[model samples]
Target chain A: MKISKEEVHYIAKLAKLHLTEEEADKMTEDFEKILSNFDAIRGVDVEGIMGETFKTTEAPHLRKDEERVFEDKKKLFQNTLDLKEGYIKVPKIIE
Target chain B: MTITIDAIKSAIEGGERLTEEIILQFYKRIEEREPEVNGFLTLCRDEALERARSIDQKRKKGEKLGRLAGVPVAIKDNISTDGMKTTCASRMLEDYIPPYDATVIKKLWDEDAIIIGKTNMDEFAMGSSNENSAFKVTSNPWDTKRVPGGSSGGSAAVVAAEMSVMSLGSDTGGSIRQPAAFCGVVGLKPTYGLVSRFGLIAFASSLDQIGPITRTVKDSAISLEVLQGHDPMDSTSYKGEASSYLESLEKGVKGLRMAVPKEFFHTKGLDPEIADSIRASIERYERLGAIVEEVSLPLMEESLAAYYLISSAEASSNLARFDGVRYGYRTKEYEKIEELMEKSRSEAFGKEVKRRIMMGTYALSSGYYDAYYNKAQKLRKIISLQYQEIFKDYDLIISPTTPILPFLKGEKTNDPLEMYLGDIYTININLAELPALSMPCGFSKEGLPIGLQLIGNHYSEATLLRAAHQLEQEIGLKSPIRKEEV
Candidate 1:
C-alpha cells in the first residue's frame, strides 16, 4: 500500500499530469492512505459471482443507420477555444 | 404560495399565476439569496424570462402547454446546455459551452419547463462536499457555516432555499441523496439506465444517474416522470414503457415488506440521534401495516473499496478528454505537447481530482489491473447478487442515508478518510445498481436534518416513492430551516 515517489511519478506520467517534487511527496502519502483503505477488501471472498455490466431487463434499442444532415455549423464552433478555417484546432498530433 | 411542482403546475393551469410572474419571483429569490448560498453557477435570466413570457402568451391565447409548462427547474452544472457554459465545477472546462443540450435538458425544454439556472457541484463530481468546486462552496440553507452535501450540493441547496421549484442532480455514489439529505429535501437516484445519460458529462458511466431533488416527494416523482425514459443515443437507457412515478405515489404501504440491514444499524460512528430517527421511521412503517424485518448484506463493508476502484478507473478514462487542445481551459507557455497536457491538467484540476486520476491510472495499469480494477469488478458482482437475493424476501431496504448530519465547512477537508466515510450507507446501493430515495425523516438535536434512505430493487422506483411518500405524510418532517430569507 505504500506509494513511493517513483510510483507517483509513473502514475503522473500515465495520467499526463506534471507534479512538482513537493506535490509528488504529498500525493505519495495520500495514495498510501487510499490504497491501504482499499486493501481491506482483500480478505472478502467473492467466488462464483459473474461480473454484471449495465443493469437492465430489456435489450438495447438499435436505431436504423441513416445519413443525418447537419443543420448548425456555426453553433458547433461557438464553444471552441481554438479554431482555424472553420475547424477546431488542437495540439498537432503529427508534425 | 406552495413551491412544490404539483402546486405550481395547478396554479399555472388554473390561471392563478402566469409563467412570467413565476419566473420573476424565482429571479428575485435568486438575486436576494445567491450572494449567501452560492447555489447557482449560471443563471439564465434572459432566456428563462423569454421562455416564461412565451408560456404566458400561450396561456392567454388559450393554447395548451406541455406538462411542465412554466415550472421553473434548476439543472446541475454537469448536464450540458446549448450556448451555456457547462463547467462541471472544474476550471478545465470553465469555458466549455456544449454545442448540444443534454437529452434531459432538451426534454425539459420541449416540455416548456423554464430553465432557471445551473447549480453548483463538486468539481467533476469528485468530492463529498462542495468545497472542491473551483467556483465557490455551496452553503446549506439550514446553516450557513455547514456544507450542503455534494457533488449535488448546489442543486439541493437551491431547492431547499426555494431559489428554484425543483432541480436536477446527477448521483454517482450518493451525490444527489447525500446532498438532499443534508438540505432536508427529497432526492431520488433512479435505477441505473432508467434515465438516459446522453449529454451528461461522463464521470463513472456505469454508475452515474441524473435524478431530481425537490421540496416534496410528489415533486421529486413528477420531475422523475419527465426525466426518465429510453434514449437511442445512450446505449444503457432502459427500453420499456415508462411509468408515472407520481401516479404511484398514493399506493400506500399496506403489505410492503421493508428490510433494515442489521449491519447498517450497527455501523460505528453513526450519530445516535440519526439512528433513533430511523428507528422511529421503522415504527411508523409498522403502524402503517408494512412488514419490517432485519436483513444482513454480508458484502456491504467492501462496497467503498470496490466503488473507489471502479469509479476512479472510469473517471480517469472519462476525464482524459479534457486536454488543453479540446474546448476547455488550456495552459500557455509549454514547449512540447507532453508538457502542454501535463501542465494544463495538473494546473487546472483540484488536489482530490488529481489524486483520484493518478490512483485510477495505477489501478488500470498493465501490472496491477487484475489486483485492483478487475478484482473490484468481481466484488461488484457479489454485492449486486447479495441485493438480488435480499430483494426476493423484501420490497425495500431502509437505512440512515448518511452516518452523520451535514458537517461545518472545512471540518473534514484535511482528513480524506473521514470524508470517504460520509458515503458508507449509500455507496452500496449505487454499486448494486438499485433505485434509492432519500427523504427527511427527522431533525438532529442540533436542528440539522436527518434523512432515511429507502433502497429498492431494480426499476422499483414506484414502490420506493410510494413508501417514502407515505412515511413523509406520517412523520411530517419540516423543511430545513433556512438561514437567510429567500
Candidate 2:
C-alpha cells in the first residue's frame, strides 16, 4: 500500500488535479497510511453478499422523460464564469 | 437555560411582533461570542433583519406565519442559500452564490425562519474535526480550546451557544451527530431519503443526509416535521407518509425493546467515561420500563473501511464537477484547458479533499475497482443485513455518539486516520442508511458534553424521537447555556 510519487501524480491526474512536489509527497504518505488502515476491509468474510447500490427500501423513481424546460435558465446560466449566448464557454478541448 | 423554539412561537402567536426583538436578542449573543467561538463564516445580518421586519409587519396584519415564525437558524456552509455564499468552508466556492436555495432552506423560509447566516465547517464536509475548514476553526462552546466536533461543528456550536434557536447540518459519516454530541445539543441524522438533498454540496452522496442541530430533543423532533417529505428534484427522496414526529415524541419508552450493540462498547478508541455514560443511559432506559439487551453487529469493524471506500469513490466522481469551467475558482495561469482544470482543482481543494479525491480516483481506477470499491459495496450489504436482523426484534439501538470526547483543536488534524476513527461508532449508521439521533446524556469530568446516540430502523424516526424525548426528561442535562452563562 506504499504509494509512490509517480502513483500519486497518476491518481491526481485522473482526478484532474495538478500538485506541487510538497503536496504530492504529503499525499503519497497519506495514501499509504489511509490505504493501510483500509486493509481491515480485506479481513472481513463477505463471500456471497449481494451489493445494494442504493440502500433505500424504495427503488429510485425517475421522472418521466419529457421536454420540460427550466423556468430559471437565465439564473442557472449566470453561475458560469464565461457564457456565450445561453451556454457556458469553456476552452476548446479538441484541435 | 433552555432555548426552545416555543418561546418565539408563543410570542408571535400572542400577536406580539417580536421577530426583530428575537433576532436582535440572538444577534447580540452572536456579536459577543462569535469571535471566540468562530462559528459563522457569513452572518446574514442585513438580510435576516429585513426578512424579520417584514414578518413582524405581516404579523401586525394578522397574516398566518409558518410553524417557525421569525426564529433565526444557522446553516452549515455546505447547504445552498440563493443570495448568500455557501462555501462549504472551501476557497473553491468562497464567493459562489448558488442560484437557488436548498430544499431545506426554502422550507425554513416558508415557515418564516430567519436565515441567521452560513456557518463554518470542514471543507466539503470532509474532516471529523472542524479544523479542516479553510476559513476558521469552530471551538467547543463548553471549552473554547476544544473543537465542536465536525464536520457540522459550526451548526452545533451556534445552537449550544444560543446564537441561533436551531441550525441545519448535513451528515456524511457522523457530521451532524458527532458535533451535536461534542457541543451538548440534540442533532438528528434522519432516515436517508427522508429529507430531500437537492442543493446540498455533494459529499459522499449516498451517505450524505441533512438533519437539524437543535438545543433540545423536542425541537429536533419539531424541526424534522418541517424538513421531511417528497421532493421531485431528488429521485432518492421518499414519497411516503412519514409519521408525525412531534406528536409521537411524547410516547413513553415503556415496553420498548432497545439493543445496546456489544461491538460499539469495545471500539479501540472508546474513552472510559464515554462508555460509562452510554451504559448508564441504557440502564436508565431499563429503569424507565424499556427492555434493554446487548446485541452484536459482527461487521461493525469492517463498516468503517467500507464507508471510506464507498464515500471516497463516490466523492471522486461527484467532486469532479468543481473544475473551473462553470463556477468556483479557476486558475489564471494555465495555458491549456486540461491544465486549467487540473491547476484550478489542485489550487482550490484543500489537502483533505485532495486526498479523498486521489484515493477515490485510485479506488475507481482500472485495476483497483473490484478489490476496493466493489468489495466495499458487497461488505455494505452484509453490514446492513446485520442491522436489519437486529432491528426486527428490537425497537431501537443505542450507542455512544462518538468514541472520545471533544479533543483540543489541532489534536488529531495531522493524523487523518486518527481523525477518521473518531466516527467509529457513528459511520455505520450512515452506511446502513438508518435514522439516528444524538443527545447530551452526560458530561465529562471537565464538563465537555457526552452524547448518547439512539438509532432506529429505517423510517422509524417517530420511535427514535419518543425514546430520545423520554431520555431527555430523565437525564435533563442543562442545555442552551444562556447569554449570561457565556
Candidate 3:
C-alpha cells in the first residue's frame, strides 16, 4: 500500500511509460491510496476457490482454420507513422 | 416526448418521413446542442446523409429494409469505425482511423442504422467521468455543470439530449450503465461474450463488453438484438443461442423472483433519495406480482479492489501494442526504440491511463504477482460464484445504478480512489460476467436523474430487458432531464 516514488518509477519503466519527477510523485501518492483500497482483498478468505483462468460455462467455439488475405493492404499500412519499402520505420533495436 | 426507434422505423417504412429527413432532423439537433454538450468527438454528417439517401432509394425500389432502417446511432470512440477516426478520446490515437469496422459497427450497417458520428469518452475507457477525455469534457444533458458518469458519457449524453436515438458503448466496469444512469437514459451492459468484443479497443478484455444506450428499454432490447451474436473474428464471442430480446420484452416480470442485495443498499455515500427511489421501484415489481427478496452478498465488499486489479492488469497487457512504430501518435524526440515507446506512451496517455498501466505493471511484477494479480483473480472467482449462487434462487437482482447522483465537474478529478469507490454497485456485474442495465427510476431534489439497476444471469438479456420494460411502463418517470427543443 505504501508505494514509494522509486517503485512507481520502476513500474512505469516496466510499463514503458516515461514519468517526470513531478508526475512520479503524484503517481506514487495515487498508487498508495488505490493500492491501500486494493489491499482489502488480501484479507479475503479464498481457501477453496481456484484462481480464474480461461474456464467458461459453455465450451468456446473454435473457428475453422482458414487463411484469407486482407484486401486493403494499402489502407492498412497507411496508418503507419513512417513507412518505407512497405515496412514500418523504427529506431534500430539491435544495432 | 422522445422519438423511439420503433417510431422512427414505422415513420420511415410508412413513408410518413423520409430516412434522409430523419437524418437531417437529428443533424440539425446535433448542430444546435452539441457545442454545449461536447458529446461528439467526430461527426460524419455527409457520409450519414449518403447512407440515408441509399436507404431511401432502397425503400423507393420496394426492397426489404433492415430492422433498424433509418435510425441514427452514435458510437463510443473506442469501437472501430473503418475510415472514420476512432480516437478513444486519447491523444495516443488522436488521428488513428481503423481500417476495418468492429463487429458491432458492421451489424449496425446491416440493420440500416445510420452512423452519425463517434461520441466522446474517457481516454481508453479508463475514467468514471468524461472529464478524462483528452479533447474535451462532455457535460451532462440534465445539468451542464455536472459530470456525465463515464467512460460512455457522450454515448449516453447524445441519446438523453435526443441528438441520436441510440448509441453503442462498451462497459468494462459499468462504463456504459453508469454514464447512462447519470444522463437519465437506458444503458445495458450485455452478458460478457454474448456480444462480440472484436474491434473494441481493449480495456480489461475479459470484463469489456459492448452494449447500447437508448431512451427506452424497448430500444435497448432492439439494439441488443442487432449487436449480440457469435462472431468468428472474436474467439470469445458466445456460440450459444441468444434469446429474441425484443420478442420476449413484453412478457413482463410476473412470478419472476427478484433479489435485492442488502450490501448495495448499505454502501457508504448512497444518497437517501436514490435509495428511496430504488426501494419504490422494487415495490412496483412486487405490485406487478413479482416476488422480491433481500439477500446477502458477502463478497460485495472486496469487488472494487479485485475489479481494479484485474482490469488494470489486463489493460496494461492489452495496451502494450500502442508503441510509436505502427499506428497512433509518436513522440518527436527519441534516440532509441525503447525511449520511443516510453516517450510516446507517456506523452499521449492521460493521467488515469498511466496510473493504471503502472499499477498493473507492479501487480504483475515478479515478486507481487501472487500477492496482487493472482489474489484479485481468486477474489473475482469467489465474488462471481457468490452471484451465481444468488441467481440459482432469483431471476433478477436490483440495486442503485450509482450510489450517488452526478456530481459537479472536477469535484472528484483529483481523487482517483473517490471515483473508484462510486463504482461499487456496478463493477461486480462485470466480474461475474452477467447482464445488467440502468434505467431512470426517479429524480433527486436538484432534478438530476436517479437510476435503478436490474441484473440477470449470464446471457439472460431478454429476462433483464423484460423486467426493465415492465417497470418502465409502471413507474413512468418520463423525461427526467430537461428536454430542450431538438
Q: Which candidate achieves the best TM-score against the true structure? A: 3
RMSD of 3: 1.4
DockQ of each: 0.59, 0.67, 0.71
Query: Best by lDDT, which number?
Result: 3
Itemize residue pairs with steric clashes in candidate 1: none
**Candidate 3: pairs in clash:** none
| lDDT tens digits by residue: candidate 1, B185-286 | 999999988999999999998889999998888888888889998898888799878988777788789999999989987887999999999999999999
Model 1: CAPRI class: medium
**Candidate 2 local lDDT, B146-185, one digit each (tens):** 9999999999999998898899999999999999999999
Poorest 10 consecutive residues by lDDT, candidate 2 chain A:
A48-57
Which one wins on DockQ? Answer: 3
Restricting to chain A, the TM-score for each candidate equals 0.77, 0.83, 0.87
Please give, for every candidate in the order listed, the TM-score of chain B alone compared with the true chain B: 0.98, 0.98, 0.98
Better of 1 and 3 by DockQ: 3
Put down candidate 3 lDDT per residue, B195-215, tens digits, no spaces.
Answer: 999999999988999999999
Q: Is candidate 2 or candidate 3 better by DockQ?
A: 3
Q: Which 10-residue window in model 1 chain B sums to the lowest lDDT?
A: B477-486
TM-score, model 3 to reference: 0.98
Candidate 2's C-alpha runs over 4 A off are: A52-56, A71-74, A84-87, B483-486
Q: If the candidates were sorted by their lDDT against the true structure, best first, what order would they fall in?
A: 3, 2, 1
